[model samples]
Target: MDRPALGDLEAFLAIVSHRSFRKAADELGLSPSSLSHMMRALEKRMGVRLINRTTRSVAPTEAGERLAARLGPALSGLDQALETVDAWRGGPSGTLRINTNEHAARRLLKEIVPTFLSRYPDMALDLVSDGRFIDIVADGFDAGIRLRESVPQDMIAVPFGGTTRFLAIASPSYLERRGVPKVPDDLLGHDCIRLRLPSGKLYRWEFEKHGEEVAIDVPGALMLDHIGLMAEAAAGGLGIAYVHELVAAPFLASGALVAVLSDWCPEIDGLCLFYPGHRHVPAGLKAFIELLREHDRRGKLG
Candidate 1:
């Protein structure tokens, strides 16, 4: 049998991995129409229908699934081999994809990325903000950011920022209507702004003090998925919000929000940069990690 073209194989793999023509096109730096044509050509060459595409989603046929199961690891190995070769000659000259929460991304970009990009002009950085915990390897991310305590035990976690604490805050007007809580349980009587997790459950508010940890399921009139939106709702006097102190600092200083339960707010391990343990760190990730360390040393990360 004649060998399949490398481009066709790559396009096929990308489409199978992302399950979206537009997303695969963006990742491969190809136009959507071009990627579609490439897939059609590959399917014709293989003499089998590979993908089942509907208006809402895409999936692989049984034959395509078998091919993907065999090709996925081979393609991953090829990518690792290329990365290993690039590492030898590198002063950080490739794209680095990272998944993180919005707060962590904002903090890292403020102190680390600007200088690193200036030094390595050829390097590209792609940061995606996601609230849910994700498998970085499955998602094709080089690294991900999460709290130190949240990182998996098998992953290598490096501290990226200083300690953080949660603050219970409310607008003055709301506080006037419903008095401040003296303790965690008092939140049960208040109109709290609850955060909804990606898994479709309310986030439990956590607090620590004097070696005692508490998780409270507070009542609320509003529920939101995004932290920024929750903050905005709190600012609008909708309800009290439990959020990171750093996130509410500006509002607190400006008197738009007033923090309560300060004594219960406890310092906890900060954000961490974590990645798969088995995979070799790419030069781009190494450079970014070093940049973070340097920034930490200088006390620039807050």
Candidate 2:
């Protein structure tokens, strides 16, 4: 049999790697339907079923797995080789995989993404928003953005955001009806809004005062996964929301929510972009780092 075209091989490889046509299509810059059609065409020409597709998941057939086991490393090497050439050429291209949380994604999209995408047309940014502290190397991410405190010490960290704090907030009406808690412990009796972490555990509200720190597992009827929604719930008079001050700022400014226990909110290290220090930095990542630093210097990024 004749060898598959480079594009077809890449399409098949992406599908197998991601285990979802939609996700693979996103990486390959093609619509899922189009990618599906191409896979069909490729399978027809190759005279075998390359992918075993089901509604819930995608996987490679036996022959396809053997092909991928052989081809994956070689294509990766070829890609790395080309990226090295691009480093000398100063035209950063190829995919840049990033793992980050919703907060950082919002900040990047708001402050940096538009300009960065326009400036580096050849570069493809693949941002995955996940709250889990995933192992970037094991998960195949080029880099990860996380709160400085949460970032692994082994990775090289670059400051991407300034120090920020969480605030305990509620609507004026809710506070008026329930009365404001004077201390973190006072939250025990109140209808506090709660947040659930990615690990499926409830987020304990952290507070600090006079060199003493405490965490409270405040009880509440309402719980949410995202900070923005938590703020919105507080604004809607659901309950006291412990969330990032940055996300709650607009609601506070609009008089939709009022902050309390401000003294208890601890100031922590800001968000950091991190990568394994041992590996060679790809040109795309290098370009992004330079751009980020430039923006920070100009006082545009925080």
Candidate number of the best TM-score: 1
- What is every candidate's alpha-carbon RMSD to the true fold? 4.1, 5.2
lDDT of 2 by residue, 185-243 (tens): 99999998889888888989989999988899999999889899999999999999999
| lDDT of candidate 1 at residue 258, scale 0 to 100 | 92
TM-score of each: 0.76, 0.74
Candidate 1: what lDDT? 0.85
What does the lDDT read for residue 5 in candidate 1? 88
Ten residues in sequence with the least summed lDDT for candidate 2:
81-90
- Candidate 2 stretches with Cα past 4 Å from truth are 1-84, 87-90
Local distance difference test, per candidate? 0.85, 0.87
Off by over 4 Å in 1: 1-90
